[model samples]
Target: MHLRIIALALTAVLTSCAGVQVHRVTDRNQPGIRYWRPAPYLALVETRTENAVACEVRPLMLPDKTEEYAITINAGLGSVKATPTLTDGWNLVSLNAEADSKTSENLTALATLLKTGAEIKARGVTKPPTQPVPTCRGVFRVDYDAAGNFKGFSRISL
Candidate 1:
């Protein structure tokens, strides 16, 4: 009876961890990138220089298993919608920058870094001043490679 209770507890913990994987990944071959879907969840990627990337990609998985993603960028300044095609269960979606020219250039550089095994820490929080709050607010120090992704994410007070 005690063994059965322990098994059930372990299963509950593992099941919750499987949802929305947020951790440090050094190897470019890690499987986290395969499950990174930027849609239906608000991903707020803020850089060290305070240049921010806030947008969500709504993925429409078609009958043929291809996905079409859509999102609007920069709500206050101007809105720009971007669509990227996903196939073969993996695809790199290019997020077009809607900020000023310089900020846009910065985001391009960051995107390149993300594609090259750079680790970004993700957490869930309530963003301030917005009636409808966001789900995940990822704070990434533009320099940390793969150290801070995994540890102490749960200790972060929401």
Candidate 2:
């Protein structure tokens, strides 16, 4: 029995769950951290037991404007949390958007940030209500830049 329990524990440690997908957009015409889904990225998790699901994507912004955007998404069993922040990376063009900087100013925000044919990265997914270790159903990601500046964020619950 002891050996079986140990083996199970080892298996769980070695196994990892699939995470949500985040996409990037390149249309300069679009304003702000663009979050567009051409092909639907289906979330396989649940919204009840796995009540927390989110995904965030970092845009391929200009080297100078890269630092201006950020994204952060969080979720849990019962409820979820979100926040957005902007840095100096924003340029004159973003001034108008930044003035209201809704995402940056809003302490709690939930918004997708991306489009198609982009490098999709598996960010994070958290599952709360676990006895000991809080496991997540989907993914949660904080969109950041090369200089470590935040652009946006997301949380997905399947």
Candidate 3:
């Protein structure tokens, strides 16, 4: 019985580590007042649990990137809220559409990803913070632990 338990534990660890998927996606529906704002290149992940999210995130384009963006996932409520810090990496250019149907679809997609234990990475360029600022772009490698917890996001060359 002890041996069986150990095997199960080992299997769980391996599964958690191997179950995660990370990649870059363009979210054209950036949320905000401006309609012509540029879209952002987002690196999103789908893990097995919520703990897989990192307290900090560093992307290749914005190495100084932090978890300045707040994304809330309420699986029970089927809702999500993302607020940007307006900082260099978390600037509004990477924003998402909040109240529109397309935004709803996007959030729903985001919810599905998080519900399955996923993470997102987005970067924006546009230093002057101007209205016609360029879109944020970046590439990243997602790192996680065997226990299904997020370790960190490692910046990688595109």
Highest TM-score model number: 1
RMSD of each candidate relative to the true structure: 22.9, 25.5, 20.6
Candidate 1: Cα lDDT at 79? 33
Q: Please give the ranking of all candidate structures by lDDT, highest first, separated by commas.
A: 3, 1, 2
lDDT of each: 0.33, 0.30, 0.35
**Residue 150 of candidate 1: its Cα lDDT?**
24
Best by lDDT: 3
Rank ordering of all candidates by TM-score, starting from the highest: 1, 3, 2
* Candidate 2 lDDT tens digits, 19-95: 11222334455333433221112122333436655432222222322323323222211222222222333311211
Point out the higher-scoring one by lDDT: 1 or 2: 1
User: Model 1, residue 83: displacement in angstroms?
Assistant: 2.9
TM-score of each: 0.19, 0.17, 0.19
* Candidate 1 lDDT tens digits, 8-68: 9877643332111123344555443332432122224333445765544222211211222
Clashing pairs in 1: 39-57
